[model samples]
Target: MSNKAQVLVIDDEPQIRKLLEITLESNGYEVSLAATAKEGIIIAANHPPDAIILDLGLPDESGHEVLIKLREWYINPVIILSVQSNEDDIVKALDNGANDYLVKPFRTGELLARIRSSLRIKISEENNPLITCGEMEFNLSARIVKKNNIIIKLTATEYTLISLMVKNEGKVLTHQYLLREVWGPGYINQSQYLRVFIAQLRKKIENDANHPEYIITESGVGYRFVCKE
Candidate 1:
């Protein structure tokens, strides 16, 4: 019921937790700190935060395991904070369900920016129950898509992809971004997955799959969902 967005920082390092607490609080956020993974999970389940900044290296368990468990029920953004800078580690964490990643010794400005961006999207998704554009309509709360007032069936993956694109309508979502959001960062290199899914989506929503008016491909870049505001 507090107007300010609540953030939970789950990290063992006191310095990191203090820094995050100060930064997030100064930015008008209600902050909570958990030094262990078990404590983080318990606090989260008891009082869910608007966003979470989780460290990969935890004393009790791997942050990856924690992220997986949170994603099983927690829908809010969970940004990974770690010292691992390798591409494989970044991709692995993302694939496991992290919303974003920030390496250790990170810039506070960028961290705030990522949190703001993620929270903005989450807020939109939660508040907007129905979205209309051209012949298509999305019942975001129900996870339902319809065209011309007729219900259209979609696989969970497809729905996830389309919903992401739709939520970010008119923005050209890069292949890496879409892949990270859809199949996780591990699939960032899998361009074919996007192509196949895009094709299937077009077949279902577009009047002519060959010439789609809703989902536009950026040719070597990514895809964008075009709609009238």
Candidate 2:
């Protein structure tokens, strides 16, 4: 396959490896398969695939360990392909670094769609330079966030959550969606985490954090990043 995009498929099962390789390749993506997490890491370091399709169960090192290693350095769209359907497993994968996930037996079409969405997000983010809301300015390129020209320090997770919300500014983001996208799927039930982060962000950007004019809450659902009309 050529021109679709390079994808690295890491799975310990030979049959599974062949299945994914054939599917991705036939669909026009160049695919590389690794049977072990160690090999996957080496391939990722050396080749730098455009995206990753990783199976959570590996023969040598577990997928979580591989994800941690990748998160320590690499930053690309990663989709987890796993038989582990447990909520904890999914959440752990998302929190560790996966951009998307698929449980075993996922249809080829669904997998491809997810991969495209992930890539689309990465490309869109790369193209974004700056976003402004009233006196607040968010510079994605510089990774700096400011209000009234005063720089504010946002924790890594805070920045992630803010960016996610800002990208969907003016749209009502559901609590489940926001928590899953930013923190992880397991965190959807953890509204307090979202509240704390939003409170912190509001304090830094809004004149009154308690009032929270910039980050507006939409009842019990989620929040909206207020934008100038």
Candidate 3:
């Protein structure tokens, strides 16, 4: 009966799989290896891991499709580790329910950090409704947001937008998803509307609107709410 956090590595590259197995095991985590999307999904379904490190390019099926299938039942974090660094692929993965994305030639330390962050967020979500990041605090139940212990005034739209981001902190929220959730299905293509509201939220919550620390822009994809602690 081992209590170590289990991490499943799903990659086609033997080298990548070996590297992750070593990195994760040495860092005190139990590891499972899979070279194909089919095998990976089966292993996950049998015994779910605390987190998953998945690659986009698979011989059997695309990792994006695999992620979609896993998200249907698996609620744990799924971090995309792939060679595809384009905005389209990144946005697609995030939209499909990946918790984080890292380029193929990534740093082991950073991957470990991402795994830790994702797992911690899972625990936090289950244990509390109050989310604190740097100088900000969000009381999900009361619908209150505070900065430096002072309540910040926010409109219904602003609060909804920020609340959505805060709830999924550390994970990228695609523009389409955010717009659809905050506004509606009709506003999914309204990127400009999202930008305006994001800017407004930053101005109210961020110490420096020009250089935001919490609501980070993911270039042409979307925004990722980071917890600065």
Candidate 4:
């Protein structure tokens, strides 16, 4: 069996597909290509990739719909690579379960970095109690969080919020979802409440609260946690 991680590229544009294939292959990944949503779904179902590069525009069906269906069973990372840069489209895709989103005309270096981040997060989800990102470390079982080997004090709500975000590193957590998970169903509409808590979490975890490195604001959406590396 090949040790290389596999990446499935689903895009209608022949040039984009070709480019991705070459780029991914040269970077030590196995590549699969699909031009339409139907074909992509079939391929993914048969041989699930370690990660997916999905385009939002497809010939047979909407890529968003394809992402929704794939999320039903495929647990691996799904990164949306779309021309649609609108906030609504980005939010919808993230809420529908995309692991990450990169607008088209993206630099290959950045795309590679996103893929690496997604793959690393997926590989780290192996029922391990300890999760480490940059200087921060989390002990899920003991409910302890540390920065640079020193324990950091956090309130109950703050710990819960940080734990949730850490567990979902590299994926966007929408305002509604974050509120519902951390606060409850009643707080789904309370974006301000979420913002305040996020700010608090950043102050505790980030090196600079004003320019946070870990908890990133998605802008008009929610937040995404990323390890600074």
RMSD each, Å: 8.2, 9.5, 2.1, 1.9
Query: What is candidate 3's lDDT per residue for 1-229, written digit by digit as tens?
Result: 6999999999999999999999999999999999999999999999999999999999999998999999999999999987956879988888788988888788987787789889887887774678788888899999999999999999999999999998888777889999999999999998899989999999998889999999998787789888875
Q: Write the per-residue lDDT of candidate 2 for residues 1-229, one digit (tens) a residue.
A: 3466899999999998899988988888899989999899999999899999988888798888898889888798888887946656766777677876777888988687777767766776655779887898999878899888889999999999888878756544666778888889789889888888888888877888878776877554457675655
Stretches of model 4 off by over 4 angstroms after superposition: none
lDDT per model vs. reference: 0.86, 0.81, 0.90, 0.89
Q: Identify the runs in model 3 with alpha carbons over 4 angstroms from their true place.
A: none
Badly placed stretches (over 4 Å) of model 1 are 126-229
Note the residue pairs that clash in candidate 4: none
Which is the leading candidate under TM-score?
4
Question: How well does candidate 4 score on lDDT at residue 216?
Answer: 88
Query: In model 3, what is the error at residue 53, expressed in angstroms?
Result: 1.3
TM-scores of the models, in the given order?
Answer: 0.61, 0.60, 0.89, 0.90
Model 4, range 54-155, lDDT digits (tens) per residue?
Answer: 999898899899999999999999999879567788788988889888888899987888899899878877878898888999999999999999999999
RMSD of 2: 9.5
Residue 143 CA error for candidate 1 (Å)? 21
Error of 1 at 168 (Å): 4.8
User: Could you tell me the lDDT of residue 75 within candidate 3?
Assistant: 98
lDDT of 4: 0.89
- The predicted structure with the larger TM-score, 2 or 4, is 4
